[model samples]
Target chain A: MGNLLRFEWRKLWQQKSLYICFGIGLAINFLALLSAKNFGALDSALGNMCVALNSGYTSFLGIYIALYACQDSSQQTIKNIYARGYSRSLVYWVKYAVSLGVTLATALLYWGFNFLLTCCFGGEVGSFITAVGQALALQLWVIIGYHGLFFGVAMLLNKLGGSIAINLIGVDCVFVVLSLIISLLKIDFNVMYYNLPNLLTDIVEASLMMPEFTSSMVLRGIIIPVLYVVTFVGAGWLVNRRRDV
Target chain B: MNENRQTNYVITTDNLTKVYGKKTVLDHVSMHVAQGDIYGFIGKNGAGKTTLMKLLLGMSQPTEGKIELFGSHQLNLGRAKIGALIEAPAFYQNCTAYENLQRFAILANAKGQDLHALLDFVGLGNVGKKKAGQFSLGMKQRLGIAIAMLGNPELLVLDEPINGLDPEGIKEIRDLLLRLNREQGVTILVSSHLLDELAKITTRYGIINNGRLVEETTATELMQNCQHKLQVLTDQPKQAEKIIKKMYPQVPLLVSESGVEVIAEDIDSGAINRALVLDGVNVRGLTAITDNMEDYFIQRMGGNNG
Candidate 1:
């Protein structure tokens, strides 16, 4: 298991996409900071940057990490990976842990840099601290949700083209169409965060300005992505065990 | 009870079948590979040769069959002890050979300094830093073979391991496979379209075609089923045929335009040459043409070009 994790870590770290995402995040935060220093809007600028950076947990960065974790299977190192005596389940979880670990690490780093700018650019330290705390909590939920969604996508597509299409187009369509229906029908739902994409939208909405929590937002923000994590991961396991390489 | 459970065979499959919708890829195929034997699985394209290997490796599920490895059932065989290469070598085009091995080592649960040993085993040592992306077809093939040796698997299943290689590449892979089997006692189940290569190192073989096993025989038995024919190249082919027929009426003959091939199952070549010499036949050259794997495969396949 340790070896599997190490192996996954190496593959994830070596890919150029992770660093690219990090760079993009840094550039965006720096740009936002520069604009705030000139215009005297540091706190608001930092909040906007946090919301955008947290989207990395849900949007592009998650896809990049999950797709890379599956490089072994995609490149036919699967047989080689399995040759060493570990059960298939262990391999699956190691990949999951590695992706989530990297996603969480980078997301924290991206948001941390943005917060540091908020402090340096005339924002009060106490308010900045509270906002960072809120950002961290929302990020945990968002990454978990994205992890579930992307794990399923990676297993189902099994190719880079298909994974990219599903994550960008398929997930967006499903979320837009369902979230539209979700709003139009006025349905009384218990677990809004139970659905991954919807929960991500809520996570984004909550991270926008204040640290207040609503029951519906919390349900949609916290529970749905967790449920998706279970549903998606289970489905991915089934596909991995049964599908042809 | 524990002693009785020890497996003498490396791979054993029972009634394995794979079906894709209306097309059945494998039909109730059962195979046994003894421990420490280089078992050559010979077949043509679309002959279910690769399907069987995939089934054993758990890359794809068998529609109907059970596979066992190392005497235990296939389900129980840990991933670390079986190294296989099926079809085209799947590789990250952007990474170097060293990086590729690093990933493979992790997946195989491979331990220790076997990395260098693995590369050296397949003759890929000292080229570790080269990008796998830039490798030639033959180089990629050799690298694939090297990757298949990861974890020092006790059983190696190579599906067309030498495909798309130059003569040198083919020879290198073939020699490496033999050495691994001889030195390390690795049981190898190698599928190949190259019949002579199979005939060279394989202790046992299974000829498959059209999704069914035509025959499973030891190399000796297959050779036994073939007649020892004498191939004669002659300028005066028609006259040579008549002279040879008149000389030995009982010798089974396969006469073609270029020459007459006599399958005198157990006759001395010198005797036939002496007789032909006595008949004033201008026999250009005569040599023993033995039966090969292709002949056995075609014979069992009932290919009617005779």
Candidate 2:
């Protein structure tokens, strides 16, 4: 298991897609910061940071996760791992762990850059730091949830273009169509609020406003996405175990 | 059950079967590959060669029966002592050949292995920093072999390792496999459509056709089975048979539907023809018949015309 993890880690870092995804996310954030009229305003810059960290960074991470997850299948290299005598369950879990680590690390890096940019160009660093600090945990879960979703799709599809497209577009479309159905039915319950994207948006909004989250809201924020992670990754693992490489 | 046989065989399978939907890809394949033997797995396309290899490596589960690796039913533990390259060589396309080897070596926990030396062993020593995606099919094969050589595996299972190589490349891979088997004592289970290439290196053979093990024999036994023979055709069949058998009393003779056959090495067909003709047995024709590995394979696959 240790060797497998190291093997996966080495392969992950070797991927140019990882760097490209990170670069694109950082470039977009930098451009958005530079173009803002109130660049020096602390509240505006941090607000922008919240949005970038939650939605923009998560999207990039999704793309990277999709690419990384399906790479072995696309290149037909997963057999090498299996041929080395590691069980499918072990391979699946190791990949899940590695992707989770990348999710956290990329989130931190995005947060760090947002912090540094806010410090360099915006107003009062103290409030900016506080807001980021408050939203960090929730943002991590949100991205982890997205990683799980994308990784599952990648594993199931095992195609480069298909996995990426589904992760970036297919998922959002389902949520959109679900939301539309709920709206047309005039349902009082807002299920979309529990979705990862909406949860991320809510976290960012609440953080910037410094609003107190109700206990139920906090639970839903953490537990819902955690459930998504468990459900999707578990299904992916089960399918991978039985399927031929 | 003998201790010597148990210790000597590197791989054994009993009634191994693989079924996909309504199709049975492998049906009751029982094979044995002994230690220190280059076992050639011969089959045409879709004959379940790769399927069986996958099952042996635990890449796929057997639908029925069992596989023992290195004389143990605990496949995963036993597989640690084996290395395999099934079908086309698969690698991280974006990674360099060295990087690919490093990743697989890391997985195999093959520390202290000289990756550069392994690369050199496979004749890819100088291909530095070039990603595997840029490599030709033959280069990828060499890299695959280098990767499989990690941990100094006791057994190497390669499926069509020389599929994409030129004649020179084929010879190089053949020599490398021979060296690995002879010097390192690595047991090899290699499958290829190139019978001539396999014939040069294989000490034992398992010929599979339509998901069935048609035959398993040693090199010497297969050579004897495909030995040269003299086929004599004459108008006087019984008289010709008598004259030939009496004349060459030491040579083994068989009368077939076509003619009388002298089944022996270095049979003098001209003298036999002269003897037959001088005895007033009108000779229709005399022909020397030989069966190579290809003919034997085709015959085993139920394509024999004679």
lDDT values for all models: 0.73, 0.84
Query: Considering summed lDDT, which 10 consecutive residues are worst modelled in model 2 chain B?
Result: B1-10
lDDT of 2 at B288: 86
Candidate 2 error regions (>4 Å)? A37-41, A44-52, A127-134, A183-188, B3-7, B233-278, B282-288, B304-306
Models 1 onward score TM values of 0.83, 0.90
Residue range A172-231, candidate 2, lDDT tens digits: 788889889999999887768667777888888877776455566678778887888788
Q: What is the TM-score of each candidate's chain B when compared with the real chain B?
A: 0.80, 0.87
Docking class of 2: medium
Residue by residue across A1-245, what tens digits does model 1's lDDT show?
Answer: 78778877887888888777677667766786778678876665356545655434354665585568567766776665554455567778888888888877877676677667776776654444454455557657767777777877787667766776676667667756776787788876533335455555555566654566565665555666676778888888877776676
lDDT of 1 by residue, B1-306 (tens): 243255377777778999999999999887878888889997777889998887787777789988777777645353457878888886677887767777776666566746776677666777857889888887788788777787778888898888889888788888888888999998899998788877789998887777887788887887788757889877767777777777788887777777788886676778767777787877789988777657667787656442
lDDT of 2 by residue, B40-110 (tens): 99987888999999999888998998898888888888888888899889988878898888888998888
Error of 1 at B271 (Å): 8.6
